[model samples]
Target: MLLAMALTLWSSIFLIIKVGYCYVNLSRKKGTVASQSSTHEGAFLASRSIDGNKGQTYRECSHTALGHSIAWFQVDLGGEYSLESVKIYYRNDANWCPYRFRQFYLDVSNGSAGSTTTLTSQRKRCYKDNTTALATPPSVIDISCKETARYVIVETTYNAQEAIYLNLSGPVLEICEIEVYGCSVGRYGESCSRCHGCSTCDIISGACQCGVSFFGPNCSNACSVYCKGNLCNNVTGSCTNGCEIGYYKDKCKWTCNPGCKNGCNRNSGSCDNGCIDGKYGIECYDVCSVGCISNCERMTGTCMCKKGWQGEKCRECSPTFYGPSCEEECSPHCYNGTCYVNNGSCIDGCTRDYTGDKCTQGLYETSPEDHGTAIGAAVGASIFVVIAVVVGVVTLRLRRKRDDSSKAQKDERKESRIKYEKETTYVNRQDHSLPGKDHSLPDSHVHLGKRPANLKTQEIGLYEIMDSGNGENKTYENDVIAKTVAPVTNTSNDASEENGNVYLVINESQLNSSHYDELHVQN
Candidate 1:
């Protein structure tokens, strides 16, 4: 008996706690009630339904016109709220309309409260009455409509097919009171707890339904800063939308590889499309080798080497290798096995007995046949030298013979000049012997008969000699031609008594003064 009493006391305490929870009657005088055409506009207005009265009298209930094809009654909760349940009290006074509210449905809408058209169009049906045929409809009904809305509506429609059993031409809806129980928006549960950083919550559990910028159980956490639209998964806190530029990963917490173009993969940070210039590898983080002709392969970083470069990364020249692809071997003659990578030339000069730029020539490897060829060339060169010497000697002898002949002719002319001088002296002495030559002429005094002082005696002699050999009728004129000098005066006229013969007579003094000592007679 004591245990039963204790159990009863505990139950009593639990009931008091349940009643203490914070839900309110959202449709009781807290909202504006409305309906389709009223039966009597002033007497049975829609406002009577939510007047905070549970009275079943005609003046306390809301009534619709009798002939309404589809009748509707609704309440505006003034603001959005989470609808938990709806308790409706139907008209029971005088049994005037027992079956009127039988075939009805309850719905909630989040549409515009200013126009009932939006409320009807966007309504979500919550409950429908399924009463038996000819059965008495209940005076009061309770419906669980766990929905978030601003408008709570009840609708009833007439069906011609069911008119035979329902005995109704159309639907006429009347209600004594409507008690909607729920919490305000963003709050939920019997306690009406607030849901932080969210739009709404579950009515029974108070679990938050996060907004675009929030995540986590209570929607208290913000999305990652790199998330595209601040949208993320509520449970995991990962970005649901993509990340911003240069960012990646599920939560958009990691940055893209620096060498990537556009961006990188969200899962692995790999550059999918391609890498930037000179970059390689999946993440585009590795650089191409310096010796690469262009960029390396995206996955391997293998370089297409430039000239004289080799290996996977083109980082080094192979041992004893040089030139294109490093395929050509260095010269064996190179000292210390070292050579230029580009041309395989010796870098430290040649080994012993080797010569030339690449150190490939041998110093003492001549054959007997080569020696014989060298001897033959020497013999031929000697013969050519001897021939040249002999020809030069013969040419020198001919030149000396011509010079001696010219000297002999000059000596003969000199002897003839001496002889002419002696003859002239004799003639001059004979002249002195002539009678009546009292005045003795000076030894230096020489005369040509009336000749101009400008006339050269040697030139006159040459002209006379040349003219005699040619047998050309050339006369001594005052004008000298380019080839010879002439007598300035007419010597032939002076000697006209000698029968038109031209004569150059030289006295002893003339022979001494004149360069030409020979006497000439020209006819």
Candidate 2:
């Protein structure tokens, strides 16, 4: 029954199995082809694609209609296969290059529009050999698609019967055989058992190519517990981006000591920033005072002892050490060399010469060392207080000096101003004999007490007068102009109105029809 079914396929090849389509299917499943074939309606039926028939005779071939530019034949493989490659065999009965299939595409789908996918070539050989005439038959095309699908479609173009376009009778699509090669069912290779999702497995040997984290024969073994998320290199079991936080060692087998911030260096186990909980020193070996408010420095464990406590380990100061820092000694008057650390009170009896608890009086003789220490402390405190006061006074004085300097600089940069006085200076009409000399223009604008050569006269406009008042018409950087202001009674001769350099701000109404013409002078 399998051989009979294979013979009826007529036109194309079937699955690239060892035998016929019957063997490829193992169980018969229906297929459909859509086209207008001149020979037989079902001649290019989809069943032929997997029939394993390579016969090239027209009577034994499968051909699609030449009326349309595109046609397709799809096959339901009954079950999804992780297809490896597609092998297509064209009719070999005669030279059919003119009607030979030229342009086409292959597509696959999971029976839904959203999942429809077009198969692409994995190698350069998937392209057509257009350099030479495709006159011969037995032409086969092989393509690969590492995808899973139950429906395989071959869409080809008929060239719209344009023979000369491709130097042939017309582009046509005909098939004689097809073969599909890939893993079988849910298993792969000769072992017949699944190699799982590992694509690196050696199918023949059932040995795994082993990706990160997995190891052993089939790459089935998970990474060691030390590995983060059980992930590591297959062979070395070493993490790639370094060990996860708090974990260390080559295999991340070791963990950081308790109370670590950013864990420790992989090999050295030293705290990255520093140890917490008052541990100190390079490797955190040195211990700080128990009374310390915070941890000590890393390099040295010298306790920044508490307020009341003194000493390296923050131990309470002894009677002999009595003072704020507990480095000073008690009075020599104290019997048995005993005195309170907080105060100078004698713990035992006082010396024969001493009478009070502190032995402040009497004829008691004191030790030179004790006396010198007391004198030195008093002197040191006095010197420190003097230095602090001096520093404060100097700081205040320097601040005041800075303020004074800033104010002086601002004063120097300010614009100078001079009040205008009524002047009788006027243009010397053609006859330069009698000059209007009273209250003349300031001498500043004259060169060596002489009238400037560039001086001229013209009617001054309102805007021009305003410009003069603003000092805009002044040509010199230090030039001053009257701002239409009255002169002050206290105006000193030392005002910036030195030299004959100044602008007049006469009223426009006063400037009416007078013989006095305005100066059109360019400074």
Candidate 3:
């Protein structure tokens, strides 16, 4: 079934193929033909080659001079065209010489037909015949040129050796007929349809190769105005790279919402980077409150309000206006009808019968007796507070005085102790001296021992002397042994008066009297 359908479809397409609609032969008596030099008294002029005749006789062929270094035959197609193919019918006569058209080449150019500079400098070689041998070659040859030009030329170089071998004067060109098939500029296809806004196109399909600012099969459609460079995909008409700022979508046809910051999404037209300040919503089209200090939440329209306003949209006045809507009146009893906007409180004192900061409390709410009692209570509380404060200050001063007095006593005792320590000079037996007396004792006699472990340095003196010791004075370094001395009286005599008594320095007040008699009796 599919094969039958395909055959029917192809039959319909062939039925529409118009007759006589092939690409035109641009060289068929339509262009002026010329050659390097004519021969046989103009019998074989170059015009005969393009006269739509393929006869091999001298009347129908084009012949050039025999003595030229190179021979060329050319035709001017009158206008430039995109050439598709070319055909050449060589002369085949009873006295045929294949060497006459040996090693020939065809060129196409936009230059003039026979100008030396145009032929040599501006021509592009499109076809060459190097494979034909000395035997009779094909009578007709077709070449696929596919070039764009206004002139077509066939050229061959003269070979001196081949010319001598063939018994010819020089190289010569003979062509019975030549045909060039192509479409006019800006047109293609067998029917020569126009390629709108295209400089080149496929000759068979009519598909155009469009330039900038154009697209589509025939390149007739223009790119969108919002496109970045007026450029787009040639087939789909979509801007492939990106759209201009504030534009979105494939063809950049949709305008972005004004609230979008930089641009929008190319596929969805949503603000990808969010909205500008004071705008919200998916496309950033919703406006935020005028009182908003900065941008709002893009999808929610929530914003931070400025001073004096509140609420999500910042449409309501703040609490400074007495209420959320800012419509509540101040207290009527306020002084001069004026009050603070924040709390609706009187700026000055309240009027006659009113009381309290806001002037809203009435004096009739309480009796005079009750008011007086309240005042008396307040005054009594004040007096009690003052008495308590005075008592606390006096107690603090008495404590400080007692502490100072105790400190003075301790300072005096410390000074006495330090003085005693300085007065009690230490001496060994070797340093001891006295006049007419042996003050030095044996090495063991001057022995010193550690003070009692229970004694505190600040509470007791290390060395002490007492009047209870013998009349000859003595010093003891240990506190316990010093208390063991017994009382003695000095005799009033001349020898005793001549000697001085050495006493050990002591702080008598630091000693415990209760333990003294026990120590004395024990010693």
Off-target runs (Cα >4 Å) in candidate 2 are: 1-43, 67-69, 103-138, 142-147, 157-172, 190-523
Model 2 lDDT per residue over 1-523, tens place: 9888777565335332333322133213344332222323555554554564566556555666554534555555656655555667766555444245555555655552123433433211223333223433236777664445665566554353445565544345566666655444444453346665565444234345476677766567766676667676654566645677787887777887755666778778777767776677555655676656467666666566665456566756655557766666777878887788878788996888777778656765556558998899999999999998997788678767965875575433221211111132432213312133334332222111222334342222322232233556743221122223222121334434332323334433333322222333332
Off by over 4 Å in 1: 1-21, 29-31, 94-97, 112-121, 159-168, 197-199, 211-216, 219-523
Q: For model 1, what is the alpha-carbon lDDT of residue 342?
A: 78
lDDT against the true structure, each candidate = 0.68, 0.52, 0.67
Structural similarity to truth (TM-score) of each candidate: 0.36, 0.31, 0.36
Clashes by residue pair, model 1: none
Report the Cα lDDT for residue 407, model 3: 64
RMSD of 3: 26.5
Native-referenced Cα lDDT, model 3: 0.67
Candidate order by decreasing lDDT: 1, 3, 2
